[model samples]
Target: MATGRSTVFEDRSHAGAALGMKLSTLLPAGEYTVLGLLRGGVPIAHEVAKTLGATLGAVAVRKLGVPSNPELAFGAIAQYGPDSARHINEAIYRRALQYFGKDELESLERGTGADLLALADTFKAYCPELAGRDLLLCDDGMATGATMKAALDLVQGLAPASIRLAVPVASPETAAGLAPQVNGICQLLTPDNFTAVGAFYEDFGQVGQDQVLEMLRATQ
Candidate 1:
């Protein structure tokens, strides 16, 4: 019952660490796996995995946007498992492509589908299988979730006993949308008027590939 001033949620890593502390108290005695949506998610997930004595792996997802308007996301694609890839596209990629130059469009086509398939293969080959397992999916924070929605859809194919989406903070709308798709959600803060993920965090720094690899190495 450490409920009081949660102002420390302002720090992304601190917020995530706090969330890990909270979840360790709440989860029941059972088997569970922690899967982080890298590369932003890896550090946060490492703590949870260590606390749970659970296996860890990456869930790679990419946002598909128009080549011209890379800022605008149309949908999300993810590498779920050895044989599962899923996409959730509320906005048509074609429309987003209008914003991109031809070169960027070709780049998108080249790097979209097959890359995710390879990523899924890597997740399955490198990490433990998640079938019928109680799984916890961790991330740095939530944006529109077009990318995460696709990742969760793919995780569903693994036939996990449950999928819990955990974040330190998120917008109420995003948390509400993901509620049905996930078995449960662990969000410490949910404000009605959310502008961006960074606004909630004090030190919203970049989590790059080097940081993720270092965390993985340390955990191993």
Candidate 2:
């Protein structure tokens, strides 16, 4: 990957601890809950929950990848409670529709969405009851904020007392767009010439399923 800024973290654990310390000061005193978006978010949120002295959980959120390029996120899909919700980047989705046409777009949604849901189910465990608690949604970092926004949309259905989004770093534009959607925002770094989330960290390796499962087990 392309390295942009100076190395910010040695690894995920170190980044989490740094983020946790900042988040600790942001959280208010109350019955609070911390939820990490799988799979990278889990490790980061683990340290944040540990610092905040709160209960922890994980939510499975999959980016709705573009048909032409899977890495390009046009939106996201996630499950909250008993229902599944989809959030779309309207501009991108419309552009994709124009490119793929009606039949092709519908087919894309059917095929890619099912695959995304199956991938989500593999990582998701039993998320705790979130009603009446102050909730903090954690992520390692954010680029377009599409996936995080989808996760937030679903969690809102659970009716938490308050909801906050926290991350170690984020693109400035993405953070600004997401700010009003939640109760509060906590970002350690918002780079100017932001290329990608991994660019800010030294060890931005892919977070594995085993690591996610271990963190969820600890919460239980």
Candidate 3:
């Protein structure tokens, strides 16, 4: 884990290129499927797949945010094909229970699960088989890492040969927490005084579904 302040990315493209260079050296030679968590991750995965000559695909995962504060995630959901995974932050969930009933929480999960499946269906045509191939999961960055955890859980069930995670920047704590779950991890920057993922990029603009689809179509 690289500590202290590192260089900020000019944008997602620049970040992707830098991360792709790092991954080329770290990842072993194999048949790889680069699965980028949409929609911010697609651009980063584009550069990575090009660098490694790997098949590119997209994954859809949604955070199960608190009822009052949607930005505060209590859990997340991700789906691929017939498999789906959900991750709950027990501590946060417990705290949430104080303000809301169990039924309300379950409702939130159900809604997120539906949205995850629907979004995954949108990209199903682009995703390749993962059963025998090495998988490289890409994302713009992770703060709490709820969504990435959910993604990892879903991917693990598909029996991939190996799985690794790559990201441009991440909170050190979140990166450390996720390290044990993967074969390997390639993170460009893990800052101690961590802030939101967007703080490290100059143009952390909104990524629409159209842009994501275009990137996936180009890969195919």
**Model 3 agreement with the true structure over 1-220: per-residue lDDT tens digits:** 5655544999888999999999989877776899999789889999899899999998888999999998788989887766788889999999999899899999888887777778988888877888978999999999999889999998999999999999999888998898998988899998888878888888999888998899888989
Residue-wise C-alpha lDDT for candidate 1, range 112-148, written one tens digit per residue: 7767666555445335588889999888777777767
| lDDT values for all models | 0.71, 0.81, 0.88
For each candidate, what TM-score against the reference? 0.81, 0.91, 0.94
Global lDDT for candidate 3? Answer: 0.88
* Selected candidate, larger TM-score, 1 vs 3: 3
Report lDDT (Cα) of residue 192, candidate 2: 82
Provide the lowest-lDDT 10-residue window in model 3.
1-10
Model 1 regions more than 4 Å off: 1-11, 91-109, 114-126
Error of 1 at 2 (Å): 16
**TM-score, ranked from best to worst:** 3, 2, 1
Better of 2 and 3 by lDDT: 3
In order, how many clashes per candidate? 7, 0, 0
The better candidate by TM-score, 2 or 3, is 3
- For candidate 1, give the lDDT of residue 89: 56
Q: How far does residue 109 in candidate 2 sit from its true spot (Å)? A: 2.8
Alpha-carbon shift of residue 98 in model 2 (angstroms): 1.8
Error of 2 at 22 (Å): 0.6
Who is ahead in TM-score, 1 or 2?
2
